[model samples]
Target: MGIDFYGVLQVPRNCTDLDIKKAYRDLALEFNPEKLQKENAKHVFALICEAYDVLSDPLRRAVFDQYGEEGLKRGVPGPDEFIKPYHYHGDAMRTYRDFFGTTSPYANLLDYLQNPAYECMTKHGKMFQQKQPPITHPLCLTLHEVFFGGIKKMKIHRLVYINDEKTKTEVKEKILTIPIKPGIRPGTELLFPEEGDQNPNQTPADVIFVTEDRPDETFSRKEDDLLMIYDVTLEEALMGTTVTVNTIDHRTIRVPITDVIYPGYEKIVENEGMPILDDYPRRGNLVINFSISFPKYLPKACKELFRKGFELAKIGGGFNQYETVNKLVLADKILRVDFNEQLPPT
Candidate 1:
């Protein structure tokens, strides 16, 4: 049977990347190969490490999802720049000793609970030794591409020392596609092995994906929620019409307005006695506001109607009035669309 990454780590599929890393570190430290002398014990520990290697990498996870373990074994193409590397086997074993008390495979972890050695192991040592790299490299990625998942390829240059002389060398750099789970906040980093210069003494630096929001797209500032602003005319607002709202999904969803429609950006949804917010009884409202604008290239008759009916103020050399901050205005004129309200009383 294939290894189950989530199952091996004992974390939910939706668990954050940091949570997954922590889980792997805890489990690996407990069952490190160096700590285990028995063949079976070492075999099981290797499986855990393999699982971590695949799951921790976004690209490897993608490969695993499609081709399983056998597929990921295929080599990824990149330039072979000589790197200073460390033995992963050594690091895993050292981490195992640090997290759990017994480095011996034969040592019963349960028994360690009764002994004092267990405390010493976890408390005294660092999980991985830190070594400085002779040179540093930089990489950058976009927010959406990182969140939805994508690939990043770059190159790093390193200086090689020959007889105390430096020669510039370049290595093909590849960060396989990462599959970022939903609801992941930005500023999360993913790490890889030996990802540094010639004297690769440094622990792999994390690929931090920072979150950014586009101004035109309305998105929820919080988890498990969405926000939008709608503009309606005085007639539609009073008549309680069906407003077809274009959503982030690029489709229109019709929502009904009520007799309580107001002129300003009104919080139609507020807490129902929730102590954290004002007791407005509506918990999740898309504050609908009202506004007035004239068709610039209006027919002479329409311009006459606006001039005769409403009060106007001067704006950019044109007469206008302060109204609700109309977020849904399209250029030229607003589309005053009233979706069909009644369907033959069906």
Candidate 2:
């Protein structure tokens, strides 16, 4: 007597397709070599795979259901009087990979239970040697592009096979349009599944476009915040100054400098940064860091005036004169001072 495939899989002959799949999945998991430590695990797993292969197909199932394994080996005659050989070509590991869409044979059983569609053969089909890995391409975008969402079309060249034999291949250019959302962060990935290389025996790999923020000349980003460095003259650092800033949206913003501007001073303009992702109205803050520029060669009279001004300010008894002097002398050939008491307004 031949082995009973239905008994091996714990499914009845009258069981539905879905029931058969479920039973096979259970048996496969129980006999998986990675999960089971029994001596005959490998043999049992092979048997489970063979059972699924024969029962999953309508023609083979009908042959086994009627004349059993003997009929399967001797071949069954179709209505057209042609005898079709019943053979199992599926590998146990490959079956698992096709079900899970991954190469790992040690898949979590709970995952299969939660989403049975993940193991649906109709969805992922099967895996073959011609299967290729996903192709990842970098999509470089400017800060301005990220600020204002738009659609961009990219041109890509993909290989196209000429015939089923795959004897010849041709390169074809395809235009792919990608939607860029507002405040799209770097490292965000967009996937075009099964759009990679073409082969006769296997499904194509996925084509992935990964977002990357290109280095901008004027701005740097921290999430939704925009940071920029503004150069101010030495005279402007002491007195008040006004700066005209060109925003990402092509708007001109006047940033007034009323308080004393020190080196590393940051001025924040709220709601003027990058747009919040998915929340168009909401925005982050624009941070402006100040850099003071001083004349390399100052006249003796100008130095005397500056020294007198410092001495007079020191007489007021509110500033640290010695630290201020040291900073002015060693300040990258320019006066650089940190006024901790003069903090930026929230």
Candidate 3:
């Protein structure tokens, strides 16, 4: 039997001209070698193009309908004379480019298919069309992942049509693997072109994954710097001590507190923060904020001993007298100190 032109394009034999056009356009795009990744894509696409060519023209279609393929090859007679034999002499790729007015039709294939109006514009030489906006999604990452780098898999569900019918649709899940680079800043965006939701009329939007650092109990990130609060007892704050910090990578870092830690004292550990993105060797500083916790109350004997000790430790200077008095009262209890008197200039 002769090749079924209507079956080739998947249109019924009684289908209208509009139906034939729609079917041909849809199948052509679906089977286009650049769009479809099938083994016999090129061969199948050529067959569809041939079917469309013979079925779309009024004269050729009438001849094929009456005489079939062999009749067309033998030439059909018209009222005045025999109509010349019909053959698909045009290049398939050239025809597709002319129809879409674009060499890369797959880039916006979905848009053309979904928006008939846009396709009409393209057919009339209006090649420029507004692109769909990029879709952004937050990708929450832990401090450990940002510090050491890791891979995150995100599952995205999108609506896919079962066939050309718009009524029937199915939700498809796609897993996207995102590489988290060391020191990638929060709000950094990774773009996947044309991977967003699909529509029959519009092209798929670009997918954007924005990085967001999840809150960590041990450290809070500020740009590339890591901030941590270290609590110390009154004795440790006053006397020399060592504070051990647990890092995000399960490593212990020892921070020495030799000097007395006054209120508002911040220890800066250089090159201990998050690694610089791309340049992993460089790093920011880790800032340690100290909080001193004093005992709730001190016994009368203990207060007296602390008073006597401050007097003996003549840790003096021009301001030694005031320092000694302030320490004596403040060490025993929480006392507010105000510098009311003017001091001699150095």
Compute the lDDT for candidate 2. 0.77
Instruction: List clashing residue pairs in candidate 1.
Output: 29-96, 58-178, 269-282, 270-282, 313-320
For every candidate, C-alpha RMSD to the true structure in Å? 22.3, 15.6, 16.4
Per-residue CA lDDT of model 1 for 113-224, tens digit only, reads 4543332232223333343332323334332332233355544443333444233344545444444443344344444444454422223333333334333444333322
The weakest ten consecutive residues by lDDT in model 1 span 271-280
Q: What is the C-alpha lDDT of each candidate?
A: 0.46, 0.77, 0.77
Tens digit per residue, CA lDDT, model 2, 292-337: 9987999896687568657865985746444454344445333334
Q: What is candidate 3's lDDT per residue for 230-267, written digit by digit as tens?
A: 99988777665787988776789998976777789889
| Model 1 misplaced regions, further than 4 Å | 1-169, 187-204, 218-220, 263-346
Ranking by lDDT: 3, 2, 1
- Candidate 1 vs 2: which has more lDDT: 2
Pairs with steric clashes in candidate 3: 111-202, 111-203, 114-200, 114-201, 115-201
lDDT of 2 at 19: 70
Assess candidate 3 and give its lDDT: 0.77
- Give candidate 2 misplaced runs (Cα > 4 Å): 1-131, 161-169, 320-346
Candidate 2 deviates by what RMSD? 15.6
Please, what's the RMSD in Å of model 1? 22.3
